[model samples]
Target: DTAFPAVHWVMMGLNPTGSFTPADEAYTMGFEGREAKKEGDMRLLKERAKELGPGGIAKLYMDKLSGTFADGAGGYHSELSLSRDYGILWKYVYGTHRDYILLLTQLFYLASLFMSLYIVINFIKKDISPEAFVIMLFVLGSFFFQMIWEAGTIYSIGIYPYVFALCVLGLNAKKEGEARKEENDDVRKPGFRYGNKSGFFISAAGFIALIAVHLRYPRESVIVSVDQFLFQANDPIALSDGMEIKQSFVSDKDFSIISLKARNFEGQFNDSVYEVSLKDGNGDLIKTNEIYGKDMTDYEFTTMDFENVPGVTDYEISIKKISGENDLIFLYYDTGHTDVYPKGKMTGITGSDTADLTFEVYDKEEPGE
Candidate 1:
């Protein structure tokens, strides 16, 4: 079963295409400097193949397979290598900035994993049937696989039904054992069984407590600052080669930070880079900053700071894509043409003359302000 897929991946590596391959260059290139090395390896392999002729083709295939495996494994290693310094479970939980919802989800998953292991232990000690033991082992394997790989929730959808099935079987077995014990004993204890009313009430009370806590403290708003926007950018405009967007606005106050609503059309690890330039009324450059797509959160306002500029000054902001590989970055714009910033207008956006890029110009408060 696995052999067929293994052979297919090896064959795909020998003749790589943009579609199917043993290794994805984009995934591997997320790490710094790997893109250049991978490209160099490809070039060197092609040159060596030409020099060796027919004999080299065989070696080339093997070489390509080797490169694919090494690169693929290296990407995983780079991710796991960090766990050596920070423990695996710690890194997995806090690898990225996680919100309360995500944190709770991770905690739930950890709890489920531990509970599954506990159930498996009890099943083994109880000398359950071979088929039941095998099923529990499969569930344990799935749980461990998820922990080791740090797979997302979508990956567990298939295994969740099995986990639930095992839970149901374990509960039934416990109830049956209790019934037999009760039949042998004369006196009935005045305590709750595993799935009795008391258990339900306890679970309900815990759930209500969670809800009360959630209601008491709502999730924080995404926009927390009091900074003002020059114009609202409600629509998105994708930037490509030869495309430039310019916005003109008059400063209402002294501001040191300029923010643009930017979004990456690709994954967070994409290598897209964009350039933002600020020019005075006379068209002389005031400041220019380059921001990487990987550094900016998707669909959020990313800011660049500079020396404060006084109010009542006319300025123009230019935004364009500098360089990227197989990714697109979008700068948001206002489609309503409300003329919110009446002092200036937007230009160079495709298909609309009145669209203005969404931007916030403000001064950040210093500490203890």
Candidate 2:
């Protein structure tokens, strides 16, 4: 196990490797300009597809869509790949899930821009300056960069500026339209005109809301569920012989309770109860706990608390699947490359590739100086 890195690789670099290397560095090194590079990539994909067949094509598609070259192929497997212009176009029209966030942002921005243009031309009664175009580019670029800064993809907040600006403009337009309508005493006209600014703005908001409902909300819910299973905020300090993830921490404040997600495969071994133990640095037992697979029910992580852990130094915690101790299972640790050392080695344990008992240690905090 490893302590969580102070900064995530994505935070330090646009590349997950945490470097400033271009995502398509492998594809673009020999080629120049955007079109030439794209053409070269297409050629490579075709050549590979012909050689590898459909499976290779599928793998290449996943690699291209992700924008990362994790598979050693030229294609990059970045989520950013799915959020770019072409990815979004394919997604909305074809209902593909290649990129998650870019399509909606692009649609909202384009709609707002077109709506603004139409209003200025027909209703604003003022000349649209050349500076507006420059401002639009500036706004778009700034929004685009901010997404990369926060997440690796254009899925978050990149569309907020466009949505906010459009909403404001729409409201102002509606106010102007209302004033004009009242002044004309147009009793024959409908109360809400289809051509009015309010209508377009409202439509834009509704469109965004629908997209949020269909995509963003569901995706977030799944992510939250997965987060519960993994210690994401900090890195695991160790992996038990059974491959259970472990970590060590020091509590500055007095607390006796702790919890963690059970390391069971989805729907496998969920009905069995496991014995858990907490021990002090002296190898003295402090508390014993138990959890059942039925109690976990689905992917919910099980938590156990030890009363009166007291403010102490060097505590160790362990969990063991006592119900089916004899069962043997093969564990596959992904080391990216097949020949990578240590992690790529075969299981030394006879019954399980993972440690039947997992352990996490916590250092005791010293009293205030």
Candidate-wise lDDT, in order? 0.54, 0.40
Off by over 4 Å in 2: 1-154, 161-246, 263-269, 325-369
lDDT of 2 by residue, 1-369 (tens): 132122222232223232333233333445665566556655653554467566754553343333321112122223222211223354443223323343454455555655555545533455334544444455556544432332223232344454456545655665676787788885746655555577567767876776776664433110010011111211112223354322223333344445554334334544455666666656578888876655653323344556435666455555555564322121223333322222112223222232211211112222331
What lDDT, from 0 to 1, does candidate 2 have? 0.40
**Model 2: residue 205 alpha-carbon error in angstroms:** 27
The TM-score obtained by model 2 is: 0.33
- Looking at model 1, the pairs that clash are none
lDDT of 1 by residue, 1-369 (tens): 111222222222334231232133222333345454455445544554466577655555444333332221123322332221223343334332123334344444444554455567677687465655777778667654433221233444556556656656666666676799899988877674544687557756866676677566544322111122333342345676678888787654466778876555455777878788989888888889997878776557788874445643778888888887744544544656554445567787656556656666656443334
